[model samples]
Structures are given as C-alpha cells and as structure tokens.
Target: MRLTRRDAIAVLAGLGVVGGGAVAVDQFDPPTAETAETGETGDGGGDGALSATVTATMTAAAAVVYPSQTEGVADFVETYVVGRARDESRRDAMRDAALELDAIARDWYGDDFADLSADDRDSLLRELGVAAADPVADGTVSERIRFHVVNELLYAFYASPTGGRLVGIENPIGHAGGTESYQRATMLEDDAGRVERAERAGDAEDVEGSEADE
Candidate 1:
C-alpha cells in the first residue's frame, strides 16, 4: 500500500501516536548549546546522555524509513532525531523504544539492529507489520517501536526544511521566503486541489443561501 504523508498523519493521529499535538512536528526545536557539544540533549539516558547504541538504532531506522542517498543523513539524524529526542519530555520512552528495537533485531537476526543488512532490516520491519493500518491497537512491542521510534524519526525528517523540499515544501516553518525552487509533487498538488474544491463548495453554499434569502 502506498503511504502518502496525509495517510501517515491521519493513521498516526487516529492511534494517538503523536502525543501533545496533531503531529510530532510541533515537538521539535532547533538544537541547543548542549546538543552541539555532546550530540544529545541529555534527557533520555540516566546520566542525561544519549547512548551510542540508541543512536545507532535510531540511525538505522531512519535509513530504512527515509533512505536518502545523500551524504548528510548522519548529520540530519543528529540534528533532527537526537536533538529533538533530547528536548522531548518523553525522551525516556524514545530511549526505551530504541533498546526494544535492538532486542527485536537480536532475537530475529542474532545481531544488533544497526548491524543488520539493509534488506534484512527492512524485512524485519515488514514482518513486524510496521505498515499495518492499526499496529497500535494490537499493543505489541513492534507496534510500540513503530509508534515511538519510527514515527518520531519520520516526523523529524518531513518537518525539516530539507525533507520538506523533497515533497516540494521549500520553507516548512522557520525559513520563510527561502529562494529554493520547489516542484510540487503529485501528492501536494492533490492536496491543494482538495482544499480548493472544499473552498469552492463552501462559496457555492454561501451563494445559494444568499439567493434563498433574496
């Protein structure tokens, strides 16, 4: 099944996967001073440090979910995933989720999640039913990983200015009036068409109401 951004959002929202907001996008801020120094926000770990294992697991997950052929994906993971996870109040949950993913990998392939081949990792995710319409309802460990880890990484990606450009959003939120040219993807164009149609329908209703009043 093809997963559009809208579908992902709706499914996550329905499952209450994105806590505290409609989407996890609002949960992130730019990296902090401490994050720059230590590559973490110091909230997820016991010593307020991010574990390398957790970092590796999340990075692997990001590769599967938002596989970019670009050179800076590691930087993106640090800036987006680590940076956002650090500031998040639910940072502990994110940490535990990473460990859980590692455990799953060890159980299935006798290796850590980061050590798995790309194909094997993707296959495992598929086996865990990550693409299921309502994985959360089952309350399985795999579903929790998908919700807490995969969804968070995905939010970090698509909400960033760089990720936005992939789907034709040049300036997502902060970088207004950016000069980068954007070619709207078919999905975005469809979204715009839906919004336009909804507005036109409302206007037609208003006109009919006015005529009836006359």
Candidate 2:
C-alpha cells in the first residue's frame, strides 16, 4: 500500500521522534558508544540500547504505517543506520520523516493512524502522494515524505518470512553449490571395487549351497 505523510508521522511519533520538518532530528548520538570496534550490541540494535526517543518513535511509526513488525528488524537499522540511512548529520531524519507522515495521517483521517485498515492505509498513502503534487500543500508533507515512507516500507514490508518467500531467498545460507565429479568420483572408486569382489565371493557361496541341496 502507498504510504502517506501522516501515516508515517504517526508511526514515528509512536516510535519516539518528536517535532517535524525535513530535519527534525539530531545525529544518532546514543550516550553509550556502541562502535563497531566494541563487537558488542549497542543502542539501536543491541540489548537495552534504545535510539533517540524521536528516532525510535519515528522508526516505530514507520513500522506502523507499513503495518509490520518482526524480530531483528530494528537491528538492521542499528548496523546500517549509521553507515547508510543518511549522513551523520541527518541521522535522525528517518525517524523524523516517519513521525511527520503519521501526524499528517492523524490530521486528515481524524483518528489514530495505526487504527486504519489496510485498504484505508493505502488510500491515505495515495492521497498523500497526490496532495504533494499540488505546489501549495501545507506543512512538511510532500513527495519526499513518500520517499521516506518508501524506504521505511522497503524495510518493514520485507521483515516477514512471507516477504523472504516472495523474493525466493531462504533464511539460513544453504550449501554452496558442489561439483558432482569431486564429491564421489575419487572416494567411491575403491569402495565400488571392494563391493564387486564381495559380490563374486557371495555368488560362489550361493553355487556351492545349491549343489549341496541338489
């Protein structure tokens, strides 16, 4: 379903991001330093480490807008957020964008954003995109809001095993492809010879038993 600015904002607000606009955020400076060197889970993805109330609120808000939640999803953000989501300066942009989208939904629908049905959610999302087409739209709601939601949806929508199924990738890495020639060719050579010898011996024994019976 298409996502609207309000749906995104409400989800972010639920996550913890406060305020609005394109940059309603700060660097994701978790008071505790969970650097890559630490080799330990830190704030954002690790145990007990929470993000900026605002960023988290925003992330959570985006989850709601997308209407999906699964394990380890937030961790994907923790590992990748610092490196890829955006520049350090716009670290909180994702969260903020989500919140802004949710707020827009709340204002337009006159109800809690999460309470909407799936069909309702999609309709609102399309409307948000349409509204942004109008140059005179108010507030921070814009096509960019849709972009943020799209990013969030990419993550949230794919959080399910169902999503993985859709993409044809299994959870655990399967065996790397193998060569038929290398697997049994060498190992079975001696084993097959031994089996043939044993079969011949067994045939001789069988002939002796048959003659004795006759």
Pick the TM-score winner: 1
Residue 53 error, candidate 2, Å: 8.7
lDDT of 2 at 213: 29
The local distance difference test score of each candidate is 0.53, 0.39
Tens digits of per-residue lDDT for model 1, 127-200: 98876734352257777777777877777666544465467663454322233234544334334543233233
Each model's TM-score? 0.56, 0.37
Among all candidates shown, the one with the greatest lDDT: 1
For model 1, the superposed segments whose C-alpha errors exceed 4 Å read 1-50, 133-138, 173-214
- RMSDs, each prediction? 14.7, 22.4
Displacement of residue 51 (Cα, Å) in model 2 is 8.0
Candidate 1 has an lDDT of 0.53
